[model samples]
Target: MKNRMTLTFDSRSENESLARVTVSGFMAPLDPTMEEMMDVKTVVSEAVTNAIIHGYDSEDGKDIELHCAYENDELVIVISDNGSGIEDVEMAKEPLYTSKPELERSGMGFTIMENFMDHVLVTSSPGNGTRVELRKKMVAKDRVCH
Candidate 1:
């Protein structure tokens, strides 16, 4: 079975949870383990946060796009933003590299997503936009009810 969903919302901090919850609910039918579900939610949160903070520079009224597709135990997620794109994707992926030092950003968003997901790909260009693609293979746990 294959399932897919696409969501576009304003780039706001409050909408971050909305994105996470929507993705989680969308994947519920696959019977993913708690750990796997959490991983998905965490990555979604990170991507949305990056879109708002770094991509759009916290500018209101911008739109952040999230697309998810699940098939054959594999889930693919893509988050994109039409805000200011990344100049150096390599440097941004490095751990502890924050463009905004004043905000005390840890700059571990990409690192966390890469660690949790099976694969992570980032495509961006200055003044263009950014698209983050994450993929994960899920194994459904056998539930034993008492």
Candidate 2:
């Protein structure tokens, strides 16, 4: 059986945790490991934070959208913002490359997503906003009790 969820919220920094928790709950049926859960939450945070900070410049009035779909062993998530889009996605994906350096940002958002998820796809235009799609396949857990 396939399951899906969508959440749209204000582009506020405080709402980042909300997005993370919502996704984690939605993924409960997957029986994901603690590490998998944390990775998913962290990626959600990164995407939502990017929308709030970089996309809207921390303006706090725009909207950030999150869509998730999953089945028995696969999950796919897409987070998008209709704020200022990326000018060069390739450059943005580089490790330690942050456009807003003065904010003390680490610029590891994309890198982290890439590391944790099985696949990451980014699409953006200068004025069309940005979308990040993350896909992962869950591995069966080993329930060995010693």
Candidate 3:
């Protein structure tokens, strides 16, 4: 069985860092490469930021849930929010397509996610909510025994 942990936090901008750090700490035992560590952190940041900004529309009192698990060389993460869900999941994944252009959003959340993780799955429904599931296989590190 994979070791797993779940976090439920308020959808606050400051909490984004908290989410990143939490995952960083959780994955410590894997001895992931520096680049792998950074990639995981970046994806977590993007997912949390999207939930706070787009899903909840930056409203307070909303909860974002993050679940993380790892077994051997693979890591899995899922972030979800119960805010305003996405209407078109396919279009939302397109590059340079953002619903909130007025906010200067780059619309690259999913793009960046896909670039970093081995698998990215997004599920949402208008007024229902959004869930981002990410999976990555950490590069094996040469273990030297003394």
Candidate 4:
């Protein structure tokens, strides 16, 4: 088991960049490799972007929550939104699949997250909101000296 951190922000596209910065700071002390840190940063961005674009429809006043916990040599991140939920989880995750293709979305959010994170899970239902959880194991063998 290791340290844990959580962050929450209102549904605002401008806030997504800040989320990435914060996640970087949270994982920095762990002395993660540049690639690992980038992976975490990208996953956080995709999750937040999905919540903003799909979950909240780029609207304001809603909220998104991000939680990070380290345990058993792995880091777990949970991104959740309180907005219109997904109608179909399986279909949503398919490669090049997106509910907002008209907006030019590549439907690669889930794919990128799945590829970068060791494990990814999505749960949502109409009017209930959606949650995307990702987990990645730390590869460093020695104690990280920060």
Error of 3 at 74 (Å): 0.7
Candidate 1, position 14, lDDT: 97
Write down the TM-score of every candidate.
0.95, 0.95, 0.95, 0.93
Residues 1-146, candidate 3: write the lDDT tens digits. 26899999999999999999999999988888899999999999999999999999989779999999998889999999999999898998999999999989999989999999999999999998999999999887786641
Q: How many residue pairs clash in each candidate?
A: 0, 0, 0, 0
Supply the global lDDT for candidate 4.
0.89
RMSD to truth, every model = 2.4, 2.7, 1.5, 1.7
lDDT of 4 by residue, 8-97 (tens): 899998889989998888776667788999999999999999999999999988889999888666888999999999999989999999
* Poorest stretch of ten by lDDT in candidate 4: 137-146
Clash count, predicted structure 3: 0
lDDT of 1 by residue, 29-146 (tens): 7788899999999999999999999999999799999999999689999999998999999999999899998998998999999999999999999988899999999975675641
Give per-residue CA lDDT, model 2, range 1-146, as digits (tens): 58998989999888999999999999988888999999999999999999889899999879899999998689999999998999999999999999999999999999999999999999999889999999999888764631
In candidate 2, position 38 carries an lDDT of: 94
lDDT of each: 0.93, 0.93, 0.93, 0.89
Of 2 and 4, the candidate ranking higher by TM-score:
2
The residue-level lDDT of candidate 3 at 3 comes to 86
Candidate scoring better on lDDT of 3 and 4: 3
Local distance difference test, candidate 3: 0.93
Give the CA lDDT, 0 to 100, for residue 37 in model 4: 94
